[model samples]
Target: MVVKLKLEELKLASVVFHHLWTRRNGLIFQDVFQSPSTVTTMAQVDHVMYKEVLTKDSERTARRQTNEFSQSWKPPAWPFYKVNFDVAFDQASGRMGIGVVIGDSEGELMECLIAPKKHVPSVFQAESYALHRVMELCIELGLSQVCFEGDAKVVIDAVNSKEEDSSWYGQKIEDLQQIMAGYPEWKIVFVHRTANVSAHTATKLAIRVSSENVWLEDDPVEVRRSIMDDLVCNVLNQS
Candidate 1:
């Protein structure tokens, strides 16, 4: 049985449990249970979960969510850097814009990267190259524990797959897997464009720079505002 909370009663609870979901969403999702213990960090909930068999088709409703109640740009736990990447293409010059943004545990910007490429044939190719470049940047920084995400569902799906993807970007996916294998722990997931707005905005900044550029601890004026917006939203989710 579940207990109901009064409008006033919820104000006194240690933590309030909101929308519930099953494990089949294929997300490294964090959930809260109304246990007697006080809620602290996300990792604290791991001990309360159990495995169960579920029909594959039962999760359709979970995937078809409307944007009304969703939260975007969720922050990572301590010591882990969360990276989000996105790509934009210019048809006039056949150039692609790629953006990568890294945020630390406190939702503070760590790095911002934007690059442009010519002769990119499709969005998938641009996204694939963006992922490859992001991984290379992470490797160069010697970052091991990380959570990598992107707004492109197709690209994120292929990056998270263990089996070799045979689509048009087959070789690109293969190379990404090889680079990821070196990390001790990592995550690759897809987020809605709403949640990935900071990275998406950085892609627009690509138009300003003539070549690849990296900025540490700071971003362009537009992306800086976008990052700050996500950071404030993160604080609201925790409260």
Candidate 2:
């Protein structure tokens, strides 16, 4: 007999098998018994996290191999700050992670946020929410001559579109436009995921945290490493 499984089905089976093995070990050594629902939920979460890691790795590789000269993270001009935003969504849990990082021309981290949003309807909505929230933050901080960057091409295109948006997230896009109109010096652009690694790292970290955390010049080690990677790459590209 031959068995055929779709890509998603194969991934689900793998996650389920891994979780079952873990449960078996727990039962044998720890005398712990988890219900079927609990096991299934664990498998689902594992699958989501595994996929996220794989996606990020793939994006990083692709960005490096691409011929695009603008693939690397570049610092903004003097007196202008670059704000990068990214989102990670878990459809199984309706939870979304939002990351925003601000850096100066020297590629030094200025401000960053790692937060989670519950009941996010979809990935598109989640990305839109991140962008909107970052805009609010910039306004609150009185930041001008800002360059906003994100990995969501669709959201970036939508925000830059002059035509009206009537989709579910249209209102949010309209709000973003209104906010942009007020700050004429502010600009939003799309970037590859690898170029937004710090924000993306913060986004992944957001999923593990329960509350919003903001840092000023003090980012988590993982996020700090990403910023350093960008800075190093910028230096190499310049030389």
Candidate 3:
């Protein structure tokens, strides 16, 4: 016959059993059963253990539901369009090249390259030159509201800051400031190199190619071809 005993007493016995098991090695249940105090302690321990297991299972189930709900949810749409540009300077040749890609909320609109008249010596200079040319292009295209992004932090900071009058690139800085002033709703930002890879590749190609300039829409094949050519040349030269 099965007997249903009070769980409170069983739990007390379990608690005593747990303490004895932890304190000594090779403990036998016979020793615990023989002691009246130990039997009561073990009953309490078992009750606590059962409660803890139930609590843990409930918590795990709640977490699983929370994760599922989060995964099923969608985020709101972004409000503004973003444009990214990159510039590469050939210090030895003194040639400056610029590459820009414009995109709206829908998708990419255009990409272009400008081979400057004078060779730019530093990456910062090339970046500034690229920004200037991009602003000019935007004006030509009749775009009023846009944002410009580049990989050069120093150039971006210089464009955004008021502490001008630096000896190096003073004229170029002033020209950029004037161009920026012309646009009422334009912003400049610095993007990481990885994010600016396409433009960077285009800029490098612009510098390497014999043609004065190359422009494309929505990352065209010609642009990719030129970039691939540059990559092949680089790899071959290294080998």
Ranked by lDDT from best down, the candidates are 2, 1, 3
lDDT of 2: 0.84
Q: lDDT for each of the candidates?
A: 0.71, 0.84, 0.59
Model 1, 1-239: lDDT tens digits are: 99998844553332223211222121243342322232222112211110100221233345555333554898889999999888887644558988899999988889999998986534556777888889889988888989998866666786777776454356777888878787859888887676888999999988567899889999889899998889888788779
Task: Give all candidate RMSDs, comma-separated.
Answer: 17.5, 9.0, 26.3
Weakest ten-residue segment in model 1 by summed lDDT: 44-53
Each model's TM-score, in the order given? 0.69, 0.73, 0.55
For candidate 1, report its TM-score.
Answer: 0.69
lDDT of 3 by residue, 1-239 (tens): 98775876666556566545533432352232224443343344345545654675676587678863211101112444456677766545557767666655444345566454463334455667778778887788777777777666666777788986544465677888888898878888775554455566667666666655645564556555543443454455547
lDDT of 2 by residue, 33-86 (tens): 867776776576456656766786786677669854657799999999999999
Instruction: List pairs with backbone clashes in candidate 2.
Output: none
RMSD of 1: 17.5
Q: Which candidate model has the greater TM-score, 1 or 2?
A: 2
lDDT of 3: 0.59
lDDT of 1: 0.71
Using TM-score as the measure, which candidate wins?
2
